[model samples]
Target: MTMQRRQFLGTMAAAGAVLGAPAVFGQAKPRVVVIGGGAGGATCARYIARDSEGAIDVILVEPSEVYYTCFFSNLYLGGFRDFESLGHRYDKLASDHGITLARDMAAGVDRDAGTVTLAGGEMLFYDRLVIAPGIDFADGSVPGWDLSKAEIMPHAYKAGPQTQLLKAQVEAMPEGGTFCMIAPPNPYRCPPGPYERISMVAHLLTQANPSAKILLVDPKEKYSKQGLFEEGWQRHYSGMITRIGPDFGGDKVEVRPEAMEVVIDGEVERVDVCNVIPGQRAGAIAEAAGVTDDTGWVPVNPHSMASRADPKVFVLGDASAQGDMPKSGFAANSQAKVAAMVIRAELSGSKAFPAKYSNTCWSLIATDDGVKVGASYEATDEKIASVDSFISQTGEDAALRKATYEESLGWYAGITADIFG
Candidate 1:
């Protein structure tokens, strides 16, 4: 942790003094078990621990030693961010907030008994549980694509070694060769992610392989901020990118990884590189805990993000089926804060505030060129509905786009601190 982050933590502690320390319950501090230390789980654990001021016992269950955020990962591909910048350790979350970091996978959850079983056979009893396991791809969502063949056609959506693999493949493409991407269906993690990835790849190829062509085989007829993306592509990378939506042979797609071929609408096309983003569902833990509905996502109370099946278990981030909120990291972090407040009120004596949430997703179309869409949300009895929204307009001046990109850098710094600290 840097001295700046340490100073921020000190200021946070000082603020806690003004709010009064949380009331402890019984002989032991109430325990909160958070699974998957990504955007949602980490933020929830940190807020509960920091705001409660030692009144709640927080345990973070994550398999990895460090977390790599899916957010800003496209910037890495565009050479605007380094791989290390995307990784965050749990040291500040544990040391500053007094959270117990358990680097272990949660294997099972016995909601009826209020206990979670770990992969190492240890059982943890919890007064409250938070499930924020992000996303897991559905099996066979893309025909003939599976985990075993990821090395040949890297999804690179998870922001780790796979991301590195995909970048390497793009850099190694033959001169004037074709690069193909099969975009995912609707309601996947990061609605604008696939398009941003296309932008980054195009930026790279402009200098490295200027004659290279990009093929976007997409299932959706239209995508998030389609006009803005189309305008940016035309302005910055004209004649190099082609998009085929569902009406134009994008829906009927099959991959042949062994032979490096993609069959679109009964026509086989060979490519030098392939990127397949399959359909997604909530992480496996949600289903294992029996919180998911027929839609493969956990249904929650929009106001508190409490699991509909069990109020004691809350689902956040991409795992949830909350309405009108895109599954971006910003949305997940916003939902975490709301859920943490509710959990703290139930476990400790912290006051619960009315649930208000917000998110903004920024994408880089080229160097110093960024576009964004965002909204504020309010929770109703039925769902978390959008209160107001905005998006980048096409034909915006370069100066404004550059400012937006710079603002994204600041947001990235602030949010990482918010989650890790």
Candidate 2:
């Protein structure tokens, strides 16, 4: 079923290039400039260019040439997958879909002028814009931890090199050493991410340094799939993982990267490695474009994923403040489809469909032991609200858990193809 979908989509992209390339108007085609080439932006760019044929000029402004997904990085940490497997390139979007891949950082957005300025001083004029730049760390949100000292305590939130560093640090921990993780607060990207990281780190430590301790200092009172995670932790890594919630001094935390120490509620604990994920907001380009609200995220129309601040722009993924949808890679890719459909309908006179979205987040607790949480969502008058939801149950049979893990592997293969192709 997944391969069929991929082949059909691939054919559509190929057909669009051949059948849709004639100039709609003499020389000037409607331009679409997409910023940030992650799940949302890459999918949006591919769909707009592929579906529109040659009616719209699609420009993807991304700083990095290769995008490493954060979704499966925890699996890499757990030794389920290699680091190289998480990386993806945009060569197909350019070669197959005829997208203009602008390998440069977007410096600013001139909404009134309909132009985006790159850091290299090139200006791209667009009739419509899509902003899917993902999240940025808030200034001074985590005391004593900032970008300058990232080497000492890597966040590993963005994937790529930081992920390698965090994995290396865990592998280098002394026997029975302590590994501390400072989890982020509410409304951040991937609610289940930190817990999954803890699980993966614990998986690694169990084999390499069985006596090592894992500490989770989290600001949130409760987390996504808490029951499932707690069960898995007890079943696979008993007495190895400890989570401190806000009521237990998780909120009041500070780090000293130089000394490799964490101060929690005025109590100091020295640790061998620290992974601190600070509070986050919409990416810098969204703020520069005046699309984000006061809460640091972009408010968008639920039906079209169009920015509420400006109808000419759309925001996707973690940067959007749409209600009820947890920010996951699946959600981002789902939202991108809705945005792409809307843009195609607006520009190319294509038929528009009602917006429906879904997401599933898979977390690996141990080798071949996986759990998942997922939901289906619909665009309501107010926001995108949950229609139905499901989660893996505690005490499920090992065979079922393994099957769920296998399902996620297929999904990862399908989604990466859907986004990149």
Candidate 3:
């Protein structure tokens, strides 16, 4: 499936030129300034540069030189992958793809002037802008938690130093200690991420501290892949995990980070380590651009991912409030391709194809035990509607589970190359 998708993307790129050469707009080439070089932005930049064949200039604004993927960071925590393996550099994008890399944060956006201001005080004027800044924690969503308290109760959602911190904290935990996780609400990045992290942590503790307990305080009534995760947890690490849902006062929770305690409905439970995944909103730059609505997400046209607020501005990935698509890297990559096609057609007069998107999220439960859920989607008048779907069944055999795990490995390599190169 991974190889086929890569080939399809390549075919789309080549088929774009069948319409003829681009129509030049002015003396200088039409420039696209892409903000936040993650799955969506990076893939969009690469596709536009590759497909447009120098008709358009692409500039990527991102603060990080090495991007660590959140998708497989849980595997790193489980010791399946090393930290360095999760990191990817944009050298190929700049050296080979002719993309200009601005290693600085995007300070603000002037939609009226079609300019993006960087933290370094450089202003980039663009014919089009793509915003894919991923996610930011919503302020005060967790009553007693904030960015400052992240060191104590690390979110580790962004997948960098905080991930290492959480791993270290988990490793240094006292024998039979409690590890508490305050899972986020719905619409968070990677719908099944927290549960995967729980499985990985359980994997670690099962080896090092078999008596250690995992306490999950989740506000959501149900979560992504609940049946699969519960079944795997029972099979692999029995008697080690406990989950508290809203019915059990999980929704009414607060944390005392300094004291390493969780307060659930006025009852305090002392914990050795805490992982607080808070409610999230679009990245700050999107809100600063005045594109985000009251829900703190940028709504976009289903056909092209162009911001509804401003057609020239496109929003992708976690920042976008497109319907039915979970905020996953694969979904972002799929959306990026559609947006890149539309942008190329609009700016460079390439052949535009109908927008089609697909996403599959693969998660590992234990060593060689993997499961997946995914769907194919298409642009409709109202939203990106799912057309077909598939999921791994609960009672799958060991061989099938291992094959799923191997398939995920292939996907990671294929996708990272597709995005960065």
Tell me how many clashing residue pairs each candidate has.
0, 0, 0
Residue-level error in angstroms, candidate 1, position 367: 1.2
**Which sections of candidate 2 miss by over 4 Å?**
1-26
Q: Give the lowest summed-lDDT range of ten residues in model 2.
A: 1-10
* Model 3 lDDT tens row, 322-379: 9989999999999999999999999878799889999999999999999999999999
TM-scores for the candidates = 0.94, 0.94, 0.94
Which clashing pairs does model 1 show? none
Query: After superposition on all CA atoms, what RMSD does each candidate show versus the true structure?
Result: 6.1, 6.1, 7.0
Task: Tell me the spans in candidate 3 whose CA falls farther than 4 Å from its real position.
Answer: 1-24
The TM-score that candidate 2 achieves is 0.94
Can you give the lDDT of residue 104 in candidate 3? 77
Cα deviation of 328, candidate 3, in Å: 0.3
What is the per-residue lDDT of model 2 for residues 78-115, given as tens digits with 9 covering 90 to 100? 88899999999988998898887777789999899888
lDDT of 2 at 396: 94
Tell me the tens digit of each residue's lDDT in model 1 across 1-421: 2223234335435654321132245446678989989999999999999999988878788878779999999888877789999999989987799887766789999998788877766567788899999999999899999999899999998989999999999999999999999999978999999999999999999989999999999999899989999999999999999999888899999999999999999999999999999999999999999999998999999999999999999999999999999999999999999999999898766789899999999999998889999999999998899999999999899999999999999999999999997
